[model samples]
Target: MRRSLQWVMYVAIKSIVVSCLLLFISGLVQAQQQDQSVTTFKELTIKSDWLGYPTPETVKSHPGARTVITNKELTESGARTVEDALRNVPGVRVFDESGTGILPNIGIRGLSPLRSEQALILVDGIPVTLAPYGQTGLSLFPLTMNAIESIDVARGGVAVHYGPNNVGGVINFVTKRIPAKKTMTIRETLSLSPSTERMLADSYIRVGGFVNDKLGLQLQGNFINGDSIRAHSDTQVTNIMADVNWYPANNIDIKGSLQYYKTKNNLPGALTPESYKQDRHQSTRPLDRFTGDTLRGSLIYNQYFDNGAEFSWTNFAHRSNRQFFFGDALNADDTSTLERSSPREFLVYGSEPRLSFYINKGIKQKISIGARYMREEVDYIVDARDLLTNEFSVARDWRFGNHAFAAYISDTFFLFDDKLKITPGVRREQVYLDFRNNQTGSKESNPTKDWLPGVDIGYQITDAIFLFGNFHESLRPVQFTQITFGGAQAAERADNFEVGLRLTPLQNIGVNLAAFRIDFDNKLEFVSQDVGFRNLGKSRHQGIETEFTWQPKQIDGLDLRTGYTYIDTEQRSGQFKGNELPLAAHHQLNFWANYSRADWNWNLNGLYQSKSFSDGANTLIENEEGSIGRIPSFWVWNAQITRNFRWDKRKIKAGLAINNMFNHNYFFRGVDFSRGRMPAPGRTLLFTAQLDF
Candidate 1:
């Protein structure tokens, strides 16, 4: 009987395999019949696609938007991260944060990217920000540029199709989907920047391939180490990610991913000018630091019905535990005081479940709807002594659970062979915080709700030219960090408008110009606790941007991506005016130009963000500036040249990177010390070599 059952199971498995093989082969044949033509356009010289949210409804009569950079772009541009790669996307502003040590903060129009999750970040449709908060900084989630297949920056209502967070638009880090052929990568970076203690080394290895037409996978891992360019600071980071995709039928596909990450740093407790001079680097001071581990997994399935109906489901979960060591240098050897640190380790974890559906085709109209449910819990305790010896105090111990729910609906209408398209969308979200973890509360936690709507319009003058505009509203509910005495503001909102023109004058060149305004209500500002519980509000912002790409006919192997942004941010209702937004620049200029021929490649890239206020308050109180607390202007230059070689089936490449090519000095302000200023990293150098088979 067991043998018979095994035989039956084997037969069923084989039959399923045979069916999938048939479907895959059929898709291949069909794909071939479609005359798979290879175009030289790597998104750089291509016109706008309806998939992006770049326009406003009434202005454009319809909505069309999307910007892309191909794998060839990554290779040719020689960018190292999402920020480094997307310098030319319309309305994007990248700014340096004093000591984050990851990458610059990214913003759209006038919205501060670091302040809220309103500006969403996605990796192949998966979120990168575990939580949006000051402590939950962007640096927490690290992504190597090498893993990117393309990057799509959608502004205005384009964010609506992505669900409710579409308020500030969306930055989708579309990962590289392995091609029909195999691919491999190896990268390494070195630094000689001045540090408090140690040097820096950042390296990564990624391999991707398809076992067949229907199955593919990508495995990647990396390590990062850098010393404080200022003082008393050192950083070490490492992470690994794995992704797999499978197609079982012509219309159905499944993808899954797993990630593990860890980071350790010599955290500077806080630097006052006196301490700053005493120790140029924070790592030279105390050893109070933070170390943490995070593990995450996600599974997604996509199905396309013959009738043009579509459905998708994404399940994701993240588990992380982190500990903060309070300053205890006063009496370390003493066992009694050794455990008397001011802060203790806490634990938290959460999960997100999402489902979406859509219908498009002959329908003249397309509709989409989706939902997400998030729940998280945190545990905290006080340490007077050992758990066995320490007496637990109800007043000091804390624990809690929080839940957030969201749902959204969006649709698009097409006219004139889709030459004119309009997309309208809306989303409703509710959040509940349960002090369920703490037994000491007369009231555990409060609940909140927010509603956000967005719109996009696009007009295709011709197949290769389109003009668009967008209106997107963003909402960010108060996160756990704002739960100081439960008096935190309910939620914040921003209404941003963007109008732009995108044209592919020729098959080999593209240009985009845009003007935007982001008016925000109750936007978070930096203020002293002595002033008020909340930051200053009533801010208005406006900006203009232009992006360009060119691949000259002479150098068919050359690709150039560049752009500029001029931002005007003001606290129209507060004390600050004429000052640029905090943590964002008023003028950002960046570019990438690469020339490749034969076995040699030359790439030059430069990034610049004009000085702006480092403090959200835009004031210098008890500050060195005496009035305006600002981050002075800065620029960084990088150049790379590579030589390619091949032996049999093996391909090899060697390159060099000159970071901050010139040993320039600059201060990174926004401080809590006698002097509120930090220095930028000095000139650094690196080399790398990669082999592929």
Candidate 2:
């Protein structure tokens, strides 16, 4: 009862504070009222299918929590990779596994970050995972930081449009678009690790132009070569892409893209407790390595009708191959003479068509209908090699196939002079999957279907305050391994809830606060050797996320952004009941501050995460394997300084960045292949230069 009273008091105080802030800012209400006009539903609904929220106003009006990390912010922060740029997001957590950012392990709201399987990752609205429905794990991430223009993350109210693995939400990496004017750019970045005595370089080139009034073309390339902090950790990456846009008529638009990406990296396998104490930077597994490549293509078509209606069709296809080599021992300390290798290849194709129209007879409404079809094929092989004989033999060979279909319908209603908006939608999914064990001469098929329903509401309480809420039912389809094992038959389901407030009390300041809860069911977990995989009972995850931004009028050319997240998770059943989930930190905070003066800019930023358990058992003691223990808290800071100059009518920029300025020592445990401690990179310095002609 005492705790309940305190919670009530807290809620009352927050409400009072918000009320006072709104009243204080009401003096500008007249100006706001004069400038405010209702945006037509058609105008707001018709935009690029890839964009989560196209404009700042749309973001504010959105019925759920959303964030956009812009290119300017990414550059000013001196971000070395996409992972570096995403660190500041309120509810997202990114753990470095490959050190080169070639592989991403992203989690949201206390979900497991392993392989980022719970989250739906997209590149310009197209799925980037090996297989969207059959195998959601992103063994090969094809995005390069130099080619990204922005990142869009949506936490809720998105299930009606996206699916299969969206319980954690949707993260879209938007690539750079073709410039309207002819331009060519060249950029290079170099970084040095003092502890490992290794140097890395990143090169980028972009050429774009408009050939005529109706046609535009662009080409981009990025190359990376480097060594991580640990021994025997060499990395190389290549990305090449071409984009085209054509406006054949006033009402028709066509866009297409082709991309190729490849990466090869050596893994410094994890270390045991004793080995870690002796030398954390030493690598015992010199032969462990990973290599991946992808070739992808996409096309989009849009047609606008005179009656305030729009139609769009999108198609995409990709081929990907990934391979990993590791020793045949559970512990890196073991002097194993045998090695294991797993190679997987995937072929995926998808198509989607959508239609949106306006109906303004009784009330302003925007209605949208869409359908999607996706097909996937996977070939998997496992091989074992003996060091004594230098011979290799196949251990397992499997083939997997999936056919998925989905349809959705949604209508958004505007009421109370556009101050109140409500949207209701539903989506249906049908999937058929089959797994063939070539070595065993056996095959199994699993067919499943589900319906997802969601609703979103947004109300403008005042000129400076907005309230939004959403409830969505989402699911994660049965993956490749789950099908291969033949124990889990149904998809994992979850009910997601979110409520938030977007406040702009002052013209120069903005704030966002949101509370979210996820009730997950039918979770899949590895059981005993006899059972293989099973559908675990239930789990609950709840959290609070808040962010603040200020561009104070008093301090010219200075900007500040900060955010905090609090998460609480519980395993509701099974042996781990009442225990916190692995890698789910209770508290996280991040901040970025930038100052500009006289052609020079300086930035300081940092991230802090509280201690978390490495295993579901919540073990407090350090285990011998270094995989079942409590992870200590850490603080990592970065700083950058840059200057702009003019060279014979050409523009030039140069900068220096220091990562891990404090020389913090941190490690991530229980990653793929090696369930032991993996040391993070130490202090590093980067130098960058760019030229535009």
Candidate 1 has its poorest 10 consecutive residues by lDDT at 40-49
Model 2 C-alpha lDDT per residue in residues 393-427, reported as the tens digit of each score: 99889988888999999888999999998989899
Cα lDDT, model 1, residue 132: 31
TM-score of 1: 0.78
TM-score to native of every candidate shown: 0.78, 0.92
Candidate 1 per-residue C-alpha lDDT over 30-145 given as tens digits, one digit per residue, 9 for 90 to 100: 54464344222111110112243222222233343345666665565456555556655656755343343554467666566652345677776656665432123353455556
True lDDT of residue 106, candidate 2: 92
Best by TM-score: 2
Give the range where candidate 2 is weakest over 10 consecutive residues by summed lDDT. 36-45
lDDT of 1 at 510: 80
Residue 497 Cα positional deviation in candidate 2, in Å, after optimal superposition: 0.5
RMSD of each: 8.5, 12.8
Model 2 has a clash total of 0
